[model samples]
Target: MSGYFIYASLHQGRPALEIVDADSRQVCLQWEYGHSASQQTLPERDNPAVDELSESEIQRLFRRLLLLSCRQSLHGQDEPEQNS
Candidate 1:
């Protein structure tokens, strides 16, 4: 309850997954889909203290995002993957 939580929400009218700090209730990372899928850091109105997060915490967030992506693919959403 004192760490980060992942939420499925909309960011700028697009489907998004957000990693929010439970204590500050601020978004630290966001993965959103629009013309393409992309990841943004500190997408909220005010930036969260991203520097405070440890490397493992950040990795956890990315792992969760990957898991969600895999699930979406398994469901056959027809979303195209973008190569950067």
Candidate 2:
């Protein structure tokens, strides 16, 4: 994974989050609830005809991504080693 991009939007009339991997161009995560309203900030608020996120929103996204990374790291440590 090179980098990540996270955005908030409405999915089926409900707020949702979409996280994508920049290198693989694959979605890594999606959260529909349990997050604060800050996660719902629209990307257009800071961009013109482009999806741009505000500074605070970007910070929140990065924080969430970091937390997710830490959690995944912990899980990875729990896995048994595999011999090729």
- TM-score against native, each model: 0.33, 0.39
TM-score of 2: 0.39
What tens digits encode model 2's per-residue C-alpha lDDT throughout 12-57?
Answer: 6556788886767778777664245645434443457233334444
Instruction: Score each candidate by Cα lDDT.
Output: 0.58, 0.62
What's the lDDT of the predicted structure labeled candidate 1? 0.58
Total clashes for model 2 = 0
Instruction: Name the top lDDT candidate.
Output: 2
The runs of at least 3 residues in candidate 2 whose Cα sits more than 4 Å from the true structure, single-residue gaps closed, are: 34-67, 71-84
Q: What tens digits encode model 1's per-residue C-alpha lDDT throughout 1-84?
A: 345687887766756677776767887567554222233434453545434333444565678668756654675554665799
